[model samples]
Target: MKQQSLALHETMEVHEMLNLKTVSMTTSKMMEGVVFDQDLKALLEKDVQQSIGAINDLQRLLKKAPKIE
Candidate 1:
């Protein structure tokens, strides 16, 4: 079915985005110590927190998503 195919495609795309965001979260945490500026460090920390929440939400959604295979 076209609908199933579309759903699978969207699920894959979301997975890819989730992976990218997870990597970004790790980099942000690591870069917190690497940054010398206080403002940038704060921003990175905030991004890290936001990414964590987003990852959790995405994972929950993924659990409810239809299996592709």
Candidate 2:
């Protein structure tokens, strides 16, 4: 099977998105404890979990890239 590779621009965009998701996860974690509304708190926790999953998936994609210098 032939292997496929991401163009450099696409890889950079993915990296940027990964950074954005990481920042969102960090903010959600910090705010979760401070939120007073029960529903909002639960929602924040869900966002945190989803963000984590997204970061993991993105990291996996980054790992699959050809190790170009």
Candidate 3:
């Protein structure tokens, strides 16, 4: 039914959001360590930003989707 579909979508949205937040936090913490050099840090930061941006875009799409009810 429409309700079930909406619930599934919402669940997926939350899962993705949580995953993104985790990745963001982990990457941020990793960056705090002085082991990595500037070049590597820049590359890693870019990847983290890309992942966060992708999740944000998905969240935006889910929010914009119209309810079937």
Candidate 4:
């Protein structure tokens, strides 16, 4: 299979999404320490897990993106 590099705009959008997900995951992880409600904590944990998967996928896609220099 031929591997194609991502377009500049698509690369930028993916990068932005990766950053946002990273921030969200970080926030959720930190909140897990202070959160008292079991249900809320569980929800945050789930979000963190999903974000991790998404970040991994984004990283793989980024590997194919053209160099920005």
Candidate 5:
């Protein structure tokens, strides 16, 4: 499949989003071990899963983005 190119600003934006998602997922996963409430733990797990999907999508877009020197 042909990869689509992203403009510099778009690439930066995606990179920022990827970083944010990574941090969010990491935080949720860590909190899962500490939270006592089952409901909140479940919510955290859901957020982690959604973040994984979003991070994967962002990584794919980044692969199409031009590499910075």
Candidate 6:
């Protein structure tokens, strides 16, 4: 009976440890995805700003040119 109890306790401990490990891995993956998403958003915003600036510069240059028939 004592040996059976020890085996049962060990099995329970191992099961709990596996669950903890799974949770830890899942959390880590979620954090990594969040970080990647944030980086992508920042890069997209920067690209948009650059495009707007280029358009404004082009408009200004166009305004400076003399009109020709």
Estimate every model's Cα lDDT from 0 to 1.
Answer: 0.86, 0.91, 0.66, 0.96, 0.95, 0.51
Clashing pairs in 4: none
Clashes per model (N, Cα, C within 3 A): 0, 0, 0, 0, 0, 0
The alpha-carbon RMSD values of the candidates against the true structure, listed in the order shown, are: 4.0, 1.1, 5.3, 1.1, 1.7, 31.5
TM-score of 3: 0.47
Per-candidate TM vs. native?
0.80, 0.89, 0.47, 0.92, 0.90, 0.42
* Candidate 2 Cα misplacement greater than 4 A, ranges: none
User: How high is the lDDT of residue 67 in model 3?
Assistant: 61
Ranking by TM-score: 4, 5, 2, 1, 3, 6
Top candidate, metric lDDT: 4
Tens digit of lDDT per residue, candidate 4, span 1-69? 998999999999999999999999999999999999999999999999999999999999999999867
Q: Model 5 over residues 1-69: C-alpha lDDT tens digits?
A: 876799999999998999999999999999999999999999999999999999999998998898779
* Best-to-worst lDDT order: 4, 5, 2, 1, 3, 6
State the displacement of the C-alpha of residue 40, model 6, in Å, after optimal TM-score superposition: 16
Write model 1 residue lDDT over 1-69, tens digit each, in one string.
333323666778779989999999999999998899999999999999999999998887676567657
- Report the number of the highest-TM-score candidate: 4
Better of 2 and 4 by lDDT: 4
lDDT score for residue 66 of model 3: 53
lDDT of 4: 0.96
Considering only N, C-alpha and C atoms within 3 Å, which residue pairs clash in candidate 5?
none
- Tell me the spans in candidate 4 whose CA falls farther than 4 Å from its real position: none
